[model samples]
Target: MNIVFPTLRNGLFGAILALSPMLAAQAKTPADQLIVGMSMVNLFSIDPANAPGLDASGINANLYDTLVKRDNGNPERHVPQLAESWTVSEDGKQITFKLRSDVKFHSGNPLTAEDVAWSLYRVMKLNFGLATTWKAYGYNLDNIQASIRATDAHTLVIDLPQPTDPLLVIDSLAISPSAVVVDRKQALQHEKNGDLGAAWLVTNEAGSGPFTLSKWSANDSLVMTRFDGYWAGPAKMKRVLVRHMTESQSLRLMLERGDLDLAYGMAAPDIKAIERSDALQVQALQRGTMYYVAMSMKQPEFAKQQVREAVRNLIDYQGIDQQVMPHYGTLNQQPMQLGLAARLPDPGYTMDVAKAKALLAEAGYPNGFNTTIRILSEPPFIDIAARMQATLAEGGIKATIVTGTGNQVYGAMRARNFEMIVARGAERYPHPYFSLRTFVYNPDNSDAAGLPNFQGWRASFFNQQLNELIDRAGVERDADQRLKLYHQAQTLYDKQVGPIMMISQMTDTAVSAADVKGFTGDDAEATRYLGVYKQR
Candidate 1:
């Protein structure tokens, strides 16, 4: 990688200058490198088995390879990756993947079916991350090992313990980290104290992707270098340096100064201004990302369906869309996102303080109640929470807001330790099953289940009616029959009151220099960097 040294013209001032804000504004990424500025507090972890948030997952996507990959060129379609081809049993209980012979890991180890099987086993054995995703389909810690196995060097088979639609398993594995194949030999060689190299892999990568983790400093920066042995051929940019920048102004300045190639986290207003610059380009694709509020049914007040409905109806949807969400998102309330099957339009529930107050009174809280709403201390989320607070106050419900980093905010939600949380949910994979599992269905809500697969557990919300619908949807082979079951679940959720669906986000804007090529506007960061070349 190329490094540049700044010339100093003064004494103590020169030292200060080198370390000042100007350092961020003036520092230039090498021409052969791609530098990204983001507002994330810090990466949680890069290990696919443990990383919970999107930023970490995005980084991991570049370092790892999945057996199957989504076709970025065509949304919601699959393509072969580490696995060149596959076959499924007529009963749909078994899937066999044929591993590619030529793929090699960054550790220089040859790819094999053993690595694919071991990697998936590790995800379940570790009992975190995608483990919950697999659990929803009946794979458990005790049975996962037996269900997935390598019969030979080039062939791996996954036998579902229960009969279900094979598409469910295929889609789940395709987009989730559960499908990422690690270099088993390398990982086992570094294993320490029975940790299975978990500690070592946090900062290191042993996969077959185009880039390998070179360096990562918490709350500072993460640097990745292209793998010369990459199976698809070398990346155009030799290095990728992502700096932690929480401010949009700094990112704009750095880009204007030609210090950075792309800025990943820009507010809508900032993006508009940046678009006017002839040297820069901006693109936005409305993603299936949802921002909503969750109420803990554990609270006696929230347990009442009437109170939940009151809270849902108290928000001024049109006002927020016009004021807070302009250019950033659009209002969408369907349990499933639009353009997907069985999607219902917004129920047209409008703001009515009187109706909300009456409902709160009916729920045994005539004087309203006081509660806390947890939200990340960042743009749009905090601001949106404030708007909700105002509306709730109008209905005699007093809401105190709590703000923290994504980890602090989401951690509490995952642990089911909050009264309410202002959160965002997205269909990481383009499938109705993802949305159904994420928001409506939770097979096991206990902490022991590591229930990250579904938001139902977080809200302490469970309906046997909704659960049964999801279960039937899982096993139904007919597309029309499956969609009917999902529609039933949505109808049930509407009547019962689940999460307060707020807005579906539009493009997460990425501004880049004019010379950048092949950057895609996508919800999954994994697809964005693949095959993206710099046109320098």
Candidate 2:
């Protein structure tokens, strides 16, 4: 809930606003500590096996240990965390990891290969979070535990259900929910019925990371205290207080007043202004995520390819990016990002209202039609959706904007109970396979399959050709052949006119006090705080 303060023009209100900083100063964390003003309503869940929200995943990353870890700058480069070394079988069907014997959980339990096997097996059994990612690699209940087993106390072996690419499975395990290792003994102590403590772990954390959950109050704040027993040594700060601030204005005010050491989710304009401040540093981190609008093929109006193509052309890509999204996003249409190999150049489509109207007429809707645009009730997204609504109106389409929380908005999309939607998607890595698998290919669009891998099911899109291409690319051993197949998939996606993919926004801007050191601008590594410290 947002608390709207009275206008500053009011005498009493002006006085109160002026005094707020002094009041907040008393509650501020010490200079040596880190206090962040974040843009989150509340944590969805802290249990790594179940928490799918980005904020919760980030917090879990700090609270848990993974076998392999990525550096602050690069997601492709994997380094050892719990496992010091590993060997892959020549047949590419099995991998054995050597667990570091010196590591211990927060509870002082020695880390063992049994914990590794149990943690991964638990994910498949629970079947949530990254469960689908494993399913994509052919690990099912019939073969999951059979394939992943501990050979000895410190040797963890993973036998692939089918030989494809071991790197893909490893990459999936490097991400949250899949990578997270829990204290199985501790969790089982609190187990209820047959849940494996999945119920109790929802609020409590059981891991061996730099910090533990000191406290978390819904819609208000979350506090994490350092764990001195951390394998990587102690965290620099004693505590990290994350205060929930929905409005960007509140974040800017708290950051400017020194009540917050860092502020995330600031508006582009506010970020631009903060960049000029001598005491503050503003940074942008590019992520493999894209914000887009889609029209469901379930609707008769969008069933025509011409209508979908017209909707794509109707987006004022340059206008919106330059005007409202400057300093925040880059105009991109395809699933492949700019830095990756085999990425195709933009098709050079610009907004032309007349062309949109012509296309609509050709599709038997001379005056366009009515639809609802679903979006989350947050900054920039709501603002962007409003801009899209206005632009569509000019092109003879009537669009109603509906805003709600992440659950409400995305839930509707996933259930296929929507006409149009505005949402953001992130690839597991900067790989064409990830995006293609996520947005385009749907092997089983039936309700029984649960549409786990393919979000395209929501839009009622199914193409056999794309499915074949994705399958071929998945198992293709030859590098050049794989790249060619991926390119072919991208071209096929464009020709199908599936969704209106817009700009790939710079994830978030971080505005922090200059004294704050070792702040990684990468949002992908948001929870990495081992090196962060305050300069004297």
Candidate 3:
């Protein structure tokens, strides 16, 4: 709901806009604290290897540091935090990191190589630790596992099976302090009810980050305070609070009314009116935030490629983009470019009414059948589902929408719950793999926090090719050949409607005017908030 109102201006550019001329004119005052607002949608976890959602992105980024955080368009490059520097072998398979011996985890112990090795060990074994990329590299277990080793107290060497390129495969891995977890075996002993290590990371801060974890309640709230001995100066804010409610209407009503400093997890249009005045600013953390619907390829309804194509054509993309979310997004024309299918073409699902009818006829479904689509009880998605139902109706398909909350929705999805779903997550940074293969390529019943391969379409062959693509993407020195393989895989994905993907371009945060300064985003979605500094 963007509005245009002319403001009195003498210059062509309109007198350098200022929300508050008096405030801008006044001398800058450095405050002791910078309070950040957390309305909802913040997941609690400081482990970069496993931090998920808006809260985690905000909290963990400040609390932990990754080995390599990207600057901008540049590939995932290294910047000092725990490791002051590192060197890659000529073949690119091995990476030798020189640690910053001065740094210590919040637990009060110095960072060490043994911890680094254990941390890698933790990531290599997904269910046991905070590392979340298990689905991304689950099949290629050989890439990790025993691949990492600590040669000395301060030096760590990683041996890749081949010349694994840093640009593609492993971005900067956020090093975990050995002082905190000590050993992987012992760490599992701390798990509550023997679920996984994520439980420990939720309320505990074993990281070498700027802030220390104090308390946490899932979907409710999390708290953190500065680590006094943090190698970096103490954080400005005395404490940080986070919550995880994803209600837009409530968030917009409460936050804009001044009850909160910031709010998220909801896509309320209420801010449009406020932004027209000087009372608010929207800080979107843009990277590659993608959202989409996936169909069960194994289902009889969607077994035919033509049926998938026809259903795609029936999507009211223009109607949705133009009507409901005029400000939120642009039409995503390809799947690979967004969501878990990064680099694949969207086909815009082309809004061809006749072609859709013809394809349906060719598939012997000229009089589209009735079907139900699954979705989260979350907003925006509910709206999206309804919109899809309406548009599919126009294509002779009767689409019923079924919605549920949390585990209920996830459980159904896991069991091949519905013919379709409007699930969220993916389009992460550092590489396309982070955005894609983590789900679509290896999605199956074995996965927990991964894509629901419930449709039971296990194209092991496609995934195998995907693995070759991953290795080549990282290690191949020839840019041309690397692109060739990338394109080859991308082509196969594009030609098939395996997943109905829609991408959300970086809408992560709004870079504030309050000197929340530093490079805010990159090819990978990570924003190194520690690098951000207030202007002196």
Candidate 4:
């Protein structure tokens, strides 16, 4: 799907006028409203516990507030939100948070420690995919209430169920979608069949953030009105209107016509064409998600280390990054994200047909092996897979590309039923421990274990040593020791020829009107619009 946008000197403005009549009528968006256009195909759920998509996180960021938030530039530091102050036990097992008394939920219920504790308990009780985060920290449905509880209306306490760094738990609280505090009384009032409002929250919200959900229609549009009683402060914009638009051309046209204040997921050509426009500003936000080529270990041919390494060499990383990933991602070979103290330099793996051929021969496949590459039928992913198919042919590997939706592509991987896959995922924040855990740690390899949360398990790549190193790194309080453990784990994964080979780190580009101010993209995709405003 190659799209060409007219150059600025070549009737670009005229093209905008001819394309969208609906948008042309409203050339200028409302001064007190922020209009955004993006694809909402993945935003089916907004329930904090079950909503795992980036779109839902962005929506929830405006609709809800967490106890704390990770500092944008510095992942190691966390600033308070609903929590006024918090302290960790010297033994590093207990944490206590003091809630702000003046805060009130959108339901007019006072936000308290009870609400905070109950929100967490609700996550464990529901046991959705998001529950994996707390489960990894040893919190379970049976033990969550006892472990995380409210001592008083103002004080909430958390007791660690196992030996791990208390900071990791704190970091999870700062970034996890399920960490947002919910109004327990309000949620229970709508509970059905003892679901704890799970069904209602799928489309509705029970939050105290800067905005309240005024209306939402799946795959249509969503409107968020500013909450006047917001404890922080009222948002500058009285309303936030997000229109669901999948066509990149439409997004570009709307943006060019001054109908859209901000647009996301536009084609690269559209973004590049408008990069130099005086009316627009483009920002590339680095996300923690990684694009990787994963081979299931369950596949007989890929179970061999030599075959795995051969497949790795057959990947055209340089070509993919230079040609296909202009606005989608940056070249990243390591499992961990960039700009972290614990991360190591990329091992510098490149496509080498001769090396791949030799490895395949050594693995008893001199005539090459036939395999399928499952990927989402979308930009960047399909492009990467196509590039891989061409390069793999050079290495004597006959691979066919199979395209499908997110559910088909990822669900197969999670079920450990695919030969290969090119997908981006698992981690959403730039934390060393979480990155390594998402990509490398698989405690149990049994199919009955059913831990799809870990991409490592999905690919059936389980290394006892790598798992131990990551587990140790998660618990080691000494910064130097933890860094060493992370380095060692990366080296071991390389030596083991791990099934998941990372090709790039994702970068989401947002093009907005130049007049839009205070619009910084959150690293975790939980972008809050509290301070956003039009300069005019």
Please provide, for model 1 over 1-536, each residue's C-alpha lDDT reduced to its tens digit, 9 standing for 90 to 100.
Answer: 11111211123233223222644555455667787877556366777787756677678778888888667623446789888888889878899999889999988889999888888888877776567777777787788778899999999999998867777677666777657888999998999988777888887878888899898886567888999888888887888888776666667776777777888766667787878888899877566667787888888999998899899778888887778775567787765666776676678878998888899999999999999888765557766888989998899888888876666778788777889887776455556767777787777666676676578877777788788888888788787988888888888888888854545544467888887788776556454465676666
What tens digits encode model 3's per-residue C-alpha lDDT throughout 342-442? 35554455467788889988999989888877766555667778878877778788877776554455456555545777665544442554444544454
Check candidate 2 and list the clashing pairs.
Answer: none
Show the lowest summed lDDT stretch of 10 residues, model 2: 1-10
Model 4: how far residue 437 lies from native, Å: 0.6
How many Å off is the CA of 193 in candidate 3?
A: 8.1
Output the worst ten-in-a-row residue range by lDDT, candidate 1. Answer: 1-10
- What TM-score would you give candidate 1 relative to the actual structure? 0.92
Per-model TM values vs. the true structure? 0.92, 0.91, 0.77, 0.92
Per-residue lDDT tens digits for candidate 4, residues 1-536, read 22111211113344344334555688798899998987675677899988877889899999999999887646678999999999999998899999899999999999999999999999888877678788899988889999999999999999999998888888899988899999999999999999999999999999999999999987568999999999988999999989876667778888887989998877788898999999999999999989899999999899999999999898888889899998999999999998888889999998888999999999999989888888755567767888888888898888888876555667788788999888888587898899998888888999987778788999998989898899888888788998899999999999999999999998999999999999999999888899999998
Winning model by lDDT: 4
Candidate models: Cα lDDT each: 0.75, 0.75, 0.53, 0.87
The C-alpha stretches of model 1 lying farther than 4 A from their native spots are: 1-28, 73-76, 500-502
Model 1, residue pairs in steric clash: none
Q: After TM-score superposition, what is the CA distance of residue 276 in candidate 3 from its true location, in Å?
A: 2.6
> Higher lDDT: candidate 3 or 4?
4
TM-score of 4: 0.92
